[model samples]
Target: MFQNPSNEAIASILKNAKTIAVVGLSDDPSRESYAVSAEMQRRGYKIIPVNPNVQEVLGERAVASLADLPEPVDIVNIFRRSEALPDVVREAVNTSAPVIWAQQGIYNEEAADIARAHGKTMVMDRCIMVMHSLFVRGA
Candidate 1:
């Protein structure tokens, strides 16, 4: 079961993060991943697209996997299904990222355990764009 994430923690992650590795980020403008990432980019966050199927997204080079990122990302924003999160979390544990966020309607306790064990701030079942609008600014 997933407990609610702390507002302060979510706020801290959003407030401090700059480069975000959007795993499963879609190039389609209609997708939530695209909309969320676009808004974040518009807010000045460097959006790193981590989709293997696409060469690039939103003008940024898309990496195939978390290990392919050229540098460490401040946040790993995943749009994959809850069942797929364990694999992504396993990959993310190898990185030095400070935060790992699963978009709304996605959460896996086991995966969250892995992230928490690795000292990452796990924010699940919450929309980053909504949180940013409500907590960070322009609410």
Candidate 2:
């Protein structure tokens, strides 16, 4: 069984993070990924969209994968399916990002194990926007 870090720890992660690389972030505003990433952008975090399907999202150029990022990010926020988490986590672990955050309802034990093995902080099955509102923005 996997458990997310304490709320205080999550708050600390959010507080220290200035940039987020959002995997599977959709161009469509109606998509949860877009809405959440957009909100995070509006809240002062730089959002880098990672989606091969889209050229851009929320004014940031969309990269095909985490390996394509121009610079290191504070966090890697994933909105992909649960089955896809391990591969994404593997890629994220290779990056300089310290935190790997799987969006609400997305989780995989393999992914969690991989992240933990790499000494990365993994937040599984949680909403980054909601967490930001609760812990960062105090909403």
Which candidate number would show the highest TM-score if scored against the true structure? Answer: 2
Give the whole-model CA lDDT for all candidates, comma-separated. Answer: 0.90, 0.95
lDDT of 1 by residue, 1-139 (tens): 5565688777778898889999999999999999999999999999999999999899999999999998879989999999999899999888778888899999999999998888777888999899999889953
Q: List the residue pairs that clash in candidate 1.
A: none
Instruction: Give me the candidate number with maximum lDDT.
Output: 2
Worst 10 residues of 1 by lDDT: 1-10
**Model 2 weakest lDDT span, ten residues long:** 130-139
List the candidates' TM-scores in order. Answer: 0.95, 0.98
Score candidate 1 by TM-score against the native: 0.95
Model 2, 20-126: lDDT tens digits are 99999999989999999988999999999999999988888889999999998999999999999999999999999999999999989999999999999999999
